[model samples]
Target: MDLVRHLECFVAVAEESHFGRAAARLGMAQPPLSQRIQRLERELGVRLFERTSRQVTITEAGTLLLAEAREVLARSESFLAAARRIRDGETGLLRAALTPDVSGETVAALLADFRRRHPGLELELRELSTAEQLAAFAAHELDVGLIHHPCDVTGLELGPVLHRDLGVLLPRGAVAAGLDEVPLAALTGYDLVLFPRDSAPAVYDDLLTACARGGYTPAAVRHGRGTSFVRGLVLSSGAVALGPRDTHLLAGPGDTDPDLVWRPLAGAAPAWRHSAAWPKGRGDAAVGAFTDAATHALRTTAGARFEPSARPLHLRPASEYWL
Candidate 1:
């Protein structure tokens, strides 16, 4: 009869691909389902399905609308569920894109504890980069994201967890061995081994600015598309980099790179903010619960290693750009 009814009927028929099953799922008869589809098509002035005596297939328009309808329905239900939860104080799935970096152990423990405390809530975890993670949250594909700090992500609510300072990981006295501990300033004189620009473009750009602030132009020795690759490069090459001390997850204490040592940067070492973020204006209980869990996790686990991301400084709702 209206948009919501049309969506419900259309989605049911599409998924079942058989009018009988769809009608059954909707607790209606086949004839009503057929009528609803026809009414929806008349309203839209488009054929949404192609029908033969034996089977039914969705038209291109139907395909497009199917995804959207499903999303709308889910989100609508989420809203209803959120309202009911407000009355009953319950929660739903806590979809999250979590960045796995320094606080891996901490994140695990936090999630585990949350799950134990709130068994009714479901957490869907997707491992993604800083950009991908933020984009997912903005698109509403993810309810929340635990991402690397310092990027201007538009269209999300950001809060600080804590702060972790950056240091140069180098060979012992590697700073003396044609290297410098002053990360940004040292860029001009030594080979800069760092993550590729694609992984975190803003970070790479910021590093450039940091270097320029030191009146230096960094010379890149090697680039890693991923973390492990960069660590491999650092192990063998005579280069230095500036990042969070915990970022050296690829290397360990007993894993002695006789040449590698960590030194605090002279200027503002590229510090990272690890915080919980979500799409703006979403008041779903799932979203709220996830944010609460993540906040608690990051707060207790992050300790002094993470800080709140500066939202005023970066783009708002940065999800749209990435998506």
Candidate 2:
């Protein structure tokens, strides 16, 4: 008495126009096929076929139901196909968040490549601090995050995506003309502009440790939430900002910020690192596909290789950093 089974029986009989032929087509005995049609007719309060010793004919009611029944079956099959596609990661939505300082060139290239590989997927991207990205991932609001390195990874899977030598962005004329690299010790007396501690504590701590190794603390510190804002502060307030070597790309083309210049930091400065992270144990197919694409993009387009960290940098013993 299953409705779909009844409809199938009805459709097969309606198309074949003979119970014996319908049963042969359905690979069933003719008796059961006849009984199913009778049950369907009784339920609908209409006879669906006219049977004679010489021939069989479909009733008007059977013809109408045949069209509706075929549509239902077709739609059911389409639904299953769509479900399979989603399971296979052939089509879906991916939401990703990233830290503001993540390189624009890297992100754009990665996105373009991923889109080419997964034309059916819809990508939603947002910029957030490392802390915000972590929170969003935990809340299940985000599928992936691009964050600064040395982050806490207690309940997440993370791998490095990019590494670049650190540099200092100083106000124009802050140092003697033509100085290519500024020694860290020379920055001891200068006020520094940096990201807030809570936004990326590990990166903030790394900066502090780097300065401490130079034999002095900064004279003063100013907090900013984004690299652009920090750079602006450096330009107007004469405070130096520490960032990646490619930080100049953040500047608008042809907008001469003659007030700002980038100088590499001397003496083995800690590298600016970025990582891609996702929730631990998440088995979403789209997330898996995206991770694979991101891994490839990082290796090829970004020219960075992922080296798995056995333990997060902050979790390591102090001796590790000292050595």
Candidate 3:
């Protein structure tokens, strides 16, 4: 028996108080409507109505069940509505990550834009490296991440790739810092302050390779991730750090240091590439929204730009690409 349909018939007859009127309201023949009500009464083992030639009157039992039937219908409608919202990615928990090197301004931009776009979604953002984000994706722990390029992406989907040209941060007292632009080969005696190799090995190795090609190799590679840490190493140890043209990246807030300068690399300086990534077959609307926000933040806040011919530059060993 179609229980809901039977209950609907019962309710209609109870409210209409006449078989002819109930059938007309339900857009069904009077005989079929009466049969449905009869079946409902049999199923429940209770008579729901008293019918005479003059009028129809609902039973006390029928009156008691009317409110329950209406409540069930209302609840069913609410369930379907919630399901639609989930399917459309309007409400849920979304786990996202950004690399440590990302500027503070870019992080704020990404958060503000993503929230504006998906106010119903709860964003759980974290600071993670490309390596950590990839591991999280493999373990099903992360939904989306802004990751540095040249890392393995064997089972991931990527968003638009953006690039930021890098410059050097050196002590202002250094001879090379006096020039309009520092050549890669100019700082022969300075050690390099770089992020730890384990954080992003592929990018780490690629950066060293680019340095070698440009005719400069650091006396020693000092690993650090925090801005203050890198700045301390650069200032105290005479080490130089490769960074974007943004001086605040290394100088930190309220830093009016007279001994620090950031200058563009004169030749073919390396460009850092980034893109939003998620597990394969999981590029849903929420992930797409995050990717759009990340791309916008990188472009507008971090001064990164999309390259028309963007591709992973250091995926393989350098020897593999040699002519």
Candidate 4:
């Protein structure tokens, strides 16, 4: 007996409560439907329905099996739909977005690997503001996105992969004879290079929080919209910028600052958590691969190198706060 036919016959009998009516619904002869039901019962080794001259009703097992049978049929339908899509060669485009602070080094290596793995798949990228990433993802413009966690979007899920801590990047030549580490209090005297107040308010607000904890606010030298440019100014102007773990990445961008150095500040390490997020929808293989690549890169790049960030990068409880 055909498995699907058995399930269909069982569903019909279970619903109509009579073999003749069930056969009418199925547009088949009554004997055929009855035979299908008998075959089904024999296959399962149990009766699914009870019948008498005056009434027909489902057994306890039949009532339970009704929903399960529907679910199995739905799953099979979905599987067939997916196979048809693949056969049609219309796996479809994948849409994505990301935070600007995530560098080529952070994601490029994984993208290269993905390209080698899936050359035919076309990817659409939208370089967006953090707000744009949040809004677009919420609106279904993107298939998946990369962003820092702790964002305010109400209906999205974040899968974190990398850990990045904010650093106080001081000019190389700045002297610290007495202080072993760069204390946030000492930041008041230097010209501060920082991110734009609007572009990353969370990061900027966290900076103020660190300053308040440290007992003073630093004066600004230059502030910018781009993370790359912030590091650039810090290197050349001998000013301070909130640095991230990937600060050394500045070396490749022609940051001629021979004197650039990172000073771990005394406060909660700012969260620069990077994650791959997707809308709550069923995704295709490429989306799965993208999320996996993101996770793999985050795990590989940050697993051991970023333990210091897991805890707040605050002052060492009883030891020197600088590293």
Candidate 5:
């Protein structure tokens, strides 16, 4: 007989003081209940109850075991409750990674909304490049990732988050200042500060291809590991950088240098795309919750007719290509 099962029978019988009543309370036949109690007594070498024709009274051993049995059942109930909460995404840690190019306002708003929805959950945020985020997801070190488009995505599932037109960041009083929009060809004479190609190869390549189409090549290229660092370099060195038109959302009043200005790129600038990624087979509730929160936040912030793409970047039409 299972020890806990027997103990349950014993406790029932001891409390009810009648075989028929105990069996009814346990939703079992009296014979089975009696047998369970007999087995339990035999295993312990002690009679848990003293029985007469009309009455059943628990002995000292029964009283002692009753307390412990109740405690065990209580703890078991607590363990099950905790497990259910974690499975429902009500309690636990959610580890999320993002590329450095992701806007700070975007991430902050996402986390704030997720926290409101799941107060018991803790969030772990890491700022990594798109490639690094993918590596972390592959190793199961990250629960979810916000990454640039045209990623490897071999064993991952992606959901499009946001898309914006490309723009150029230039120092004040630069050669392109008078124009409302800067043509790609007009950037030929300026030193370009760009994120390293290894950090986001497809985005970098698309930028180069677009420039080539415009019949211009950068006079010099300087690499930076992150958006903020590259922007800083552009401010200090009078270099130009290309970024999403909404890049200003990531900046505070004092975040951008007073002399720097962001202007839309004239004619056929490729759109910048970002997506949420996770392991293909991952079924964790926290991952799903975070993804939902991120999608909603992006839509709310974009405030336009934003639509998530149903296909991967590579499969999308040429017009929708992300740079």
Candidate 6:
């Protein structure tokens, strides 16, 4: 028997105190309503009603069960409503990550926007590189990630790609920094300061390829995972790091590394592409919200732009360079 249905019939009959009236109120035939009550009574081993040709009355057992039945029905409704809320992503935990190279301002803007758009969602954000995010996705430990492109994304779905033209971050006193814009061949002898290759191998290799194509191959490539560390290398080691024009924002407030300057390459030689990624077939409203917020933050705060004719995303070989 459908227990809830039987309970409804029982309650209706008890309240109406007449089989014909109860059946009409339930929008069912009197015989079926009576049969359902009989089945419920058989399953519970109790007679729920005292009936006669003249009148029908709820028995003591029915009277005691009526309140409990109503409570169960209310709880069922509450359970379904809660399930729907979660399905709609109205209230739940969303595990999200961002690449470390994203500027602080962009991260802050994304957080503020996501919170504003989805006040009920609890966001657990983490700083992870492209490779680390891929691992997290594989392990099912992450929900969504703002990841750098030109990396492996075989099993993931991507959001719209945003592009940021890269410039060289060099010591302010360097001769090349004196120029309004730095040409690729101008700093031939300097080493390159870049993030560890393992952090994002494809992007790392593709960047090196682009530099070589522009006639600016470095003497050596030095790895620095943090902005301050990259700046230190550029200052003390005579190396230059590639970054967006707003790379100074990575520094703390009132602590913009005055010794370092970002100069655009003559042709925007190398650009960084980014997009939101999640496992295929796993997107939900929370993920979509994060993706939208990330795109907006990257464009506004990170000075990123979307290409009108963006190419398909895939792992490009290090032998080829892309703009």
Candidate 4, 1-323: lDDT as tens digits: 67876897888888788888889999999887777887888899888878787767899988889999988878878888867766443355667776666555756766775566556666786666566787787677887777654455456655544666666666666774124456677767767665564554554565566565776565654776575677667666656776665545345332364556665655555546666777665355676667666666655654413334453322222221122
What do the candidate models score in CA lDDT, each in turn? Answer: 0.67, 0.73, 0.85, 0.65, 0.75, 0.86
Candidate 6 residue-wise lDDT, 7-74, digit = tens: 88988998999999999999999999999999999999998999999999899999999999898888
TM-score (all chains, Cα) for each model:
0.59, 0.82, 0.84, 0.59, 0.84, 0.87
Candidate 2 lowest-lDDT run of ten: 314-323
Q: Candidate 1, 133: how far from true, in Å?
A: 2.2
> Model 5 over residues 83-169: C-alpha lDDT tens digits?
999877788888898677656677788889888878888999888888788778777898888777776778888765567677788
In order of lDDT, best first, we have 6, 3, 5, 2, 1, 4
Clashing pairs in 2: 172-259
The top-ranked prediction according to TM-score is: 6
Better of 5 and 6 by lDDT: 6
Worst 10-residue stretch by lDDT in candidate 6?
A: 248-257
2 or 3: which has the higher lDDT?
3
Model 4 stretches with alpha carbons more than 4 Å out: 1-90, 116-120, 176-181, 235-238, 252-257, 266-268, 282-284, 302-323
Task: State the weakest 10-residue window (summed lDDT) of model 3.
Answer: 314-323
Kindly give the stretch of ten consecutive residues in candidate 4 with the minimal lDDT sum: 314-323
Query: Evaluated with lDDT, which candidate comes out highest?
Result: 6
TM-score order, best first, reads: 6, 3, 5, 2, 1, 4
Range of the 10 consecutive residues with the lowest summed lDDT in candidate 1: 314-323
Clashes of each: 19, 1, 0, 4, 0, 0
Judge candidate 3 at residue 274 and give its lDDT. 88
Regions of candidate 6 where Cα sits further than 4 Å from its true position: 42-47, 247-256, 318-323
Candidate 4 at 71: error in angstroms? 35
